[model samples]
Target: MKEDKRPILVFGATGRQGGAVAEALLKARWPVRAIVRDIAAPKSVALRQAGAELVEGSFADLDTFRAGMDSAHGVFSVLPANLSETEEVRIGCGIADLAAESGVAHLVYSSGASSGDTPTGIARFDAKPRIEAHIRWLPVTATIIRPMIFMDMLINPAFGLSEGRYTFFLRPDQSMQLIAVEDIGKFVAAIFADGIRFSGRTIKIASDTVTGRQLGEIFSEAAGRPVIYSRFADEVLAANSDLGQLAAILDNGPLADHVDLAAMREINPEIISFRAWLATQRHQAFDALIGSDRTSHSA
Candidate 1:
């Protein structure tokens, strides 16, 4: 089949979610144009090698965003949550506005699981619903994807993987949804391919659901050693209000993912489970973390 000539412009292409979207679009034979702050960066170079056209740009630059969106048929939008909630909302809304003005056919906004019609009292989570509202008001067709917790986050040293114990927000029997970072791209690509089917839809996505104990079991099996799992200790939570708030949100239900895994799999059949994700691209990293005695200061 002849590849689509019109490209899908992707934001944050140097980062995980956008990079995944770019790769998946490329695999599906859709032309991809990635916006990056530096085209010379290693990840940008990798994107170029993978056949993505690189556009130098930052979220703060409207001109760069317009240039990237030029002649684009679709857009995969994602922003880092490291910024203040106000800044996140600004950047996200700005992207949607640009996409609308650029006459982009479809806009897929990657949001967090906690975002919805009501406020979650978490600034980061609330920022997304605001963005979603902005996108809906725009003239352009849009899809909002609320992705569950990332499987990739499990291997982070901050999770105490290096200590043979994983401490997270969920209770021992409490199940949380998770998605492989790579699958985010697959879902985006699918949405872009059939815009009418997904347009105006707010979809929550996940590859697997597991409790804290299940996470420990999976980690132990994958690492060939017994790994323990426990909820964040009281002192630990007290020391970090942000962590405490997140834990409370998880327990209270808004932040806890309730995605339909079977339905998501039907949309993107290659969706990877938590165990599968750890055993694949993350295997080496997970192995290294398990073997190391280095402690992480961040929660």
Candidate 2:
């Protein structure tokens, strides 16, 4: 197979979504240039070893953005959501602006699933749409992807996984969409490969849909012990404003995740279901979480 000579500059290459995109792009034979704050960091070094050309840069530095975008054919843009909303918007829009000025052929921005059409009134949810709008006005050809809740979040110990139960934003009967971190990369690579098909398009992507009850069943089966699933207790949500708003969003707002799973699978057939993903990548974690609390009664 002929190699793709044009390089794609990847931001946040040391982080989850961006790292996945870089790996997927490399697997697809696309040359990848990753911008990192620390060239000697283990993650950055691993990326370099995996064939990414690392360029030291920071989001606060416009010169680094220009240097990375220089001679690049495409860019995978992702920003850490924990940053102040102003900072997030600035860095996100700045990357898009630079990519356009540099004449990059394609730019893909990774936004959140809850962002679109209307504001969710939450800072994190609201920030992406602002970035999305900025990318649209630019002269560059761009694709925006709104990825659903990450499946990996299910295994988090904070979610009561250490107590033989799972607590999340969804009610027992409420179904929500989720995607694996690895699949995010696949979708981005596909978007970069056929920009004509995905350009100017803002699509939501997910691998599977499951209800809170279904999640319990899957967890139980995976751990070989019954695990209960429940929504965050009323007091829990009431106390933490961010958690409360997020739970409310999952209940009735945009975070409900209305992704077309079949079409997403058609685009990338290897997208793993929640059960399959748990079985493969998260089996040991699941085992450990369950094994850690042997005295906890099953729900």
Clash pairs, model 1 backbone: none
The parts of candidate 1 lying over 4 Å away from their true place are 1-4, 234-239, 292-299
Please, what are the lDDT tens digits per residue for candidate 1 over residues 225-252?
7789999998989899888888877887
Consecutive 10-residue window with the lowest summed lDDT within model 2: 290-299
Q: Write the per-residue lDDT of candidate 2 for residues 218-284, one digit (tens) a residue.
A: 8877777778898888998999988988888888778775777789988888999898888777666
In candidate 2, stretches whose alpha carbon ends up further than 4 angstroms from where it belongs are 292-299
**Highest lDDT: which candidate?**
2
Let me know the TM-score candidate 1 reaches against the reference structure. 0.92
Q: Which candidate has the highest TM-score of all?
A: 2
In order, the Cα lDDT scores of the candidates are 0.85, 0.87
Alpha-carbon RMSD, candidate 2: 3.1
